[model samples]
Structures are given as structure tokens and as C-alpha cells.
Target: MLLAHPALLADRVREYETLSALDADEGGAAARRRMDDIAYSLCVATGTADVDAAVVAARHRLPGARVHDDSLITAMHRLRR
Candidate 1:
């Protein structure tokens, strides 16, 4: 959705990351996952071709992501001013 229509969800990923970072690990496996998410978001924000690579990196980090599916879904619907 982000890469396909970045305008629709500009900075949303950053919002998600910021909120997630409040409790996200500093430098653990989970942190790496969040970093992947950050990278992905940044790519989306910049309309960069690197979004694909970011997704792949995020996928590789999924096992250690430790993020619950419900949380992700909730994040998708959430928006910060």
C-alpha cells in the first residue's frame, strides 16, 4: 500500500515506529526488526526503489520481530496527529 500509493499513507510508518519505539528493544533482535520497519518506512516516505529491499530485510527479521500480528493490524488503522 505504501509503495503503491505513498501519498495515502505518508509518515504513517514513522508514526507506527515512533509509537512502537517507546517500548521497542534498544538493540536486540526485536530492535533489528523495528529497524527494518524504519528502513521500510523511510523508503516509502522518499518514494525510493529501496522499498522492495526493505521489505525483504523486514521479512528476514520477522522471526525475531517479536511483534504481534494484532499490534500490526491495529497500527495500520491508527493515525497520530
Candidate 2:
């Protein structure tokens, strides 16, 4: 979606990143995690329809990145209403 048209979601990540920066701690680790969450959500949302490709792309984006166990990804995937 947005990838096909980068501009569509261009500022979104930056906006979220800025929001994350506000919560900077321990030299911005919290902010980094927030950025990761933002990216993960985008990829996951895109991947839900194409799980394989999306997961691969997301993983590639963070090859050695270790996501926190208690991150928001699980909660985002769980909410159903």
C-alpha cells in the first residue's frame, strides 16, 4: 500500500518517531523500541494479508534487532472488538 506510494506514509513514521522521542530514556532506548513498534505495526498490518512476504521484509529490516518480549505487538494482534 504505502510502499507502493512512499509519500502516503512518509510522515507517519517520523511523527510516531517524534512521539517516541518524547519518552526517551537511557539514551533513547525507549524511543528506539517505539520506532520498532511503529515499523512492526506497519509491516504486520501489511503482512496480515501476505504473511510470508511481510514477515520476511520486516525481519530483514531488523536482521539482528531483538524486540522486547512485552512489546505492543502482541496486544495489537490480540484486540478483537
Candidate 3:
């Protein structure tokens, strides 16, 4: 499987989070569409079906990610060693 570059994943994650935090009255349809797009992108990048899982996966793949962190990806990486 081809993994997404950490920098790109980080940017997507930040964009998703920022859009998610917007007020319902803010940004209108454009923001919603962008959020959906980001969610889909993140899912594809992480090879996961769920956005929450995708976010975790992206974070785990980021540079300086703690090997000892308790995330599922961290455990998986450990098992692969």
C-alpha cells in the first residue's frame, strides 16, 4: 500500500480540524463541502474507512510520532517489528 507523505497528511488533518470547528452559521455550504472532501482524502490517505480512524492513522504516521504512544497504529507498528 502506498502511504501518504506525513507533511500532506498533517496539512489535511489541520484543514479538517479547522473546518470542523467552524460555527454552523459560518462558511455555509463551501465549508461543509471542503470538510467532506478533506474527510474523504484523509480516509483514502490512511487506507481506513472511518474518518476518526483515519485521523489517528495519519497522526501515527507523522514525523516524531511517539513509538510508545497508546494508539492502535503504534501497537500495530510495534507488532510489525
On TM-score, the candidate that comes out on top is: 3
Tens digits of per-residue lDDT for model 3 on 1-81?
Answer: 999999999999998887777752267887777888999999999999999999989998999897576788878999999
User: What is candidate 2's lDDT per residue for 1-81, written digit by digit as tens?
Assistant: 444233323444455546645654334676767666665665654554443454444443443435555546778778842
Compared with the true structure, the alpha-carbon lDDT of candidate 3 equals 0.88
Cα-based TM-score, every candidate: 0.29, 0.30, 0.76
Q: Candidate 2's C-alpha lDDT?
A: 0.50
Tens digit per residue, CA lDDT, model 1, 15-37: 54564557554567876686667
- Which residue runs of candidate 3 sit more than 4 Å off their true CA positions? 23-27, 70-81
RMSD of 2: 14.1
**Candidate 1 wrong stretches, greater than 4 Å:** 1-26, 51-81
- Backbone steric clashes in candidate 1, count: 0
Can you list the residue pairs that collide in candidate 2?
none
- Measured with C-alpha atoms, the lDDT of residue 57 in candidate 3 is 91
RMSD after CA superposition, every candidate: 13.7, 14.1, 7.5
List the lowest-lDDT window of 10 residues for candidate 2.
1-10
- Between candidates 2 and 3, the TM-score winner: 3
State the TM-score for model 2: 0.30
